[model samples]
Target: RESNNAMQMVEGLGEDDDLLRVAQELPEPSDLLESDDDAPIIRLINAVLTSAVKENASDIHIEPYENRLVIRFRVDGVLKEVLQSRRAVAPLVVSRIKVMSKLDIAEKRLPQDGRISLRVAGRAVDVRVSTMPSGHGERVVLRLLDKHAGRLDLSHLGMDARTQATMDALIHKPHGIILVTGPTGSGKTTTLYAALERINDNTRNIMTVEDPIEYYIDGIGQSQVNTKVEMTFARGLRAILRQDPDVVMVGEIRDLETAEIAVQASLTGHLVLSTLHTNTAVGAVTRLRDMGVEPFLLSSSLIGVLAQRLVRLLDPATKEAYRASDYECSVLGVDPADPPTLYRVPDGLSAGEGYRGRTGIYELVPIDDSIRTMIHDGAGEHELERYARTLSPSIRDDGLRKVLAGDTTLEEVLRVTRGD
Candidate 1:
């Protein structure tokens, strides 16, 4: 009887019209006890959160269409579409989230943003929500920020020992700029956070200027970039410099002004750390120079560059594992006949696992005299790549060495690096 009534109520409502009204007037659970569809939509949202946490997902995206809602989760830097809900149910689900976030229900054409917190298994989790207009309907993205996940160690980041040591040395410098270069989702932020953690001291002042301020750190000051109101990286850096900070972290070096400011800060007795969207570490210098910063300024201000890429890790529990391909072996000049494995599995040898967790493959180059001279002379990416190759092993070699050493799986390395 209750199920019949709720279905009748839904039928009485017009399609996609006055959704808020119907949502506001939803019958109590007791009044519609038998209607599963009439059950509070909050329960379904909570279920999604629970499942996402269980899968260790970092983000959730909900895309609504004329007939359905597609839900995706970003886990370990990979986006996977997991579920879909009927169009009749999507609005209720979206409305519940909007209500929880205290957003305007009637506003569908414009973007809306909000956040919510929840406790699961005695751990507090922060979920950042963003909704934007789409052709069929609104698309929603939620970034799950788990504070309890804690920080990661440098060694665990898949960087070779030599590169790790180089980074360690760079961070210990009293003053200079250390720029991490990579495409987005290359774990640059995590690497910077680890470096910051290493230098964090009670007596020192470490500040950061980020767009959305992804994660929170103890004993460090982080500022969000608000371009709408004029709190950009350049302005933020100016203010941060006036505060007598020992170390400064800029989220990105986008414009020439911000790059100039960061370089200037590094030249003037401040240890600056920031990221650039370049393919390689050496490319960072060239890109900065192209951004109107003089070569001399770069040669003087820049101290080190760490370029990285993410590789996938194979599951140790699986019997059929992965092996480095001939192409990969060729890249590292490793002979398959004389296999000197670093990390391996007992069962061994299978095709890729579609995808796996990501590991960093780094090319860290310290700005020594030779490198400085090369940069001053307008060196290209090849120069940097050649120099980096000479100073350190290729990313493949380091990852294969780690695989042979049993630090990480061969499949995992190949997964991200797309090796053999």
Candidate 2:
């Protein structure tokens, strides 16, 4: 019913081209808040959200300054200014968002987090709303998760054939933990979901314990962590194990307790999936050991780790094929004498940004007996990484592969995997 109401509220609001015009038509700031009917403000907010969804934006930023209000949309992992409004109207806009997300409008001094489920033009969207106090005013960010983005599949996750096959085999195991490691906003959750989807079928029970369930899939049990009631990843994961789940997904392994529980679950005949906030696949093992998961238990339960990063794809229409320079070849580890022809974004497109979409470049390492021995012996990150390098490509290598394949540019690859 709320979704329907949200859909109805956005009805008749201008779309991409007319969103600014609709915002311009908003009533006076004071009048917007004082009016009994919130139709004007509602329409303006609805239009902004609708346009964002239509644009496939991952996040929406509503920032207020002393002189003006700036609304930006994060598209393909890059922020672009979408709309601007008068500074006087910022409060009304922020207040409306709070009301829709069911947050306290009066509580602007403290940061607040809320979720808003809406259906915009028949598209189901789950928005994670966060508000923070700023010098000028309250700033808002909305993470738009389009529930109808369709089925998650490994084949669609931009993994190479060998990596996808390895992932498929890892997730299909009857027991063991498959970890996807990456920094925040690097498509770790999406990759996990795709792995789950790949293995999801009748005759096996799949369950998840997430901080907040981002996407809902049929035939899978997903539980949200409610810290207000002391329900957390560890608690929820323990409960899930009691339910006789064949597969378990913990949103993240934040502490030793959750890591131990996940390790136990994986060892006790459950295929476990989870993520870690590490920059590389080998770093995940080190992070787990640092979190107090015994090296022996990690060795026995860990099956593989996939480290990934999002790199913007060059605009095919504007990209020109060119031979890589010797410096580029050296950076990419390609033989300098015979550099490969690579594609690059020319200066004429999208104001030289020259990127239209993003794809994940991944480093997948499947744990074998040798690597397991190293893990059991309390190997450090450097030692494990040195050995893991022989087993799989590094994240930068994968990014370089994508660059050579013309899926992305060297500059973009370097931009995302600079540290590696």
Candidate 3:
């Protein structure tokens, strides 16, 4: 079956002879700069894109090495090699992608970022294209943003009843900052979008300043940062505040200026939503403090912080029930004598291999009066974390809960929450 799938992918990209023949038949220099609707390269690229969307891939990688050109797809947060073609065809494929994204195909020396908005299988997809120079050739990556996937509600975000209730209350709060902290590709943007969707009633003026708007939703004013034109997160956020926005979503708080602006915005009256690159919920406070935000300001403006990670779910058809070891039971906070029935991704399966799609494991920390007091007093991360444990489960604990409930494997949870 795997070989058949590979053959299909190869056929989709066409054989090397077909690629070479089409490359030579191209219309000199000018046609190469334009997207030819009937071109073989166009069909090959489209086929790859269509397959990616159909397979629910998050990113498409076109990498060229000394021996061959490789195409990979990141599905369920794992990259898999899907196809390989002739090394000589690397330039043609890279140039075609650059042309399609409207980037300077001739400028192969520097990095470039662009976007492609297209429909595949009747579903709208927004592809963020990035190209970088390599020894063999230019390497390109396409980040796929499925509009349907972006519409996930909070209830469908793998949050338990209590966590969902906490999230609902936090997002509905009139004023204060609620942060979704996670590393890149950890579904931070999706969570923020879900919160915005929940509160978007057309009565409130919702506004956002994103590095690049990933998904489009009606009734919300979305602005993209244009650094070339002096528009950055801080600058765009400043402009958003003046627009009479009831709620503001900053894609990320990267600098002290942006963090201060977000804090001030929340203090002034608008509810603020943003993300931070942190390993845990408590670490977000320390990160902001390190960014020069006053502890008091952070305590006052912060309402909640949700730390999340994506873990691949087990394939129910293939998963087998097993017994948990003593250490596993201890980690899950269960007594060894009453170890729960656990499930794994089959016995012979190798590590880093996925069983099915991915789901979120989250730590939702709602800052209460006591926690607020702790933060206002400049409490350390260890202290804050110790307090947070009393209110909600840590990210790893949440993952373990999913493990106990048979949602995912213990290994999958530990894989994502290794830092914790």
- Best of the candidates, lDDT: 2
lDDT of 2 by residue, 48-106 (tens): 88888887889999999999999999988989998889898888889988878889999
- Top candidate by TM-score: 2
Candidates in order, TM-scores: namely 0.83, 0.95, 0.90
Task: Please provide, for model 1 over 1-420, each residue's C-alpha lDDT reduced to its tens digit, 9 standing for 90 to 100.
Answer: 212332233333333333234344546434444565634564456556666776678898888888777888888777877776565666666766776666788899999987766663344566788989898777888888776636456877877667888899999898999999887888888899889888887878999999777778888999999877999999999999999999999999999999989988998899999999887677888788889999888888899888777766655564343466676566446797764544344434433333355678787878898888888888887876788777766655666665665556665666555631
**Candidate 3 has what TM-score?**
0.90
lDDT of 3 by residue, 32-143 (tens): 5464453556656767777787778999999999988898999888888877776766788788777667899899999999887676656767779999999998999999
**Residue 349 lDDT, candidate 2, scale 0-100:** 61
Runs of candidate 1 with Cα error greater than 4 angstroms are 1-39, 319-329, 339-356, 403-420
Kindly report which residue pairs in candidate 3 clash with one another. none
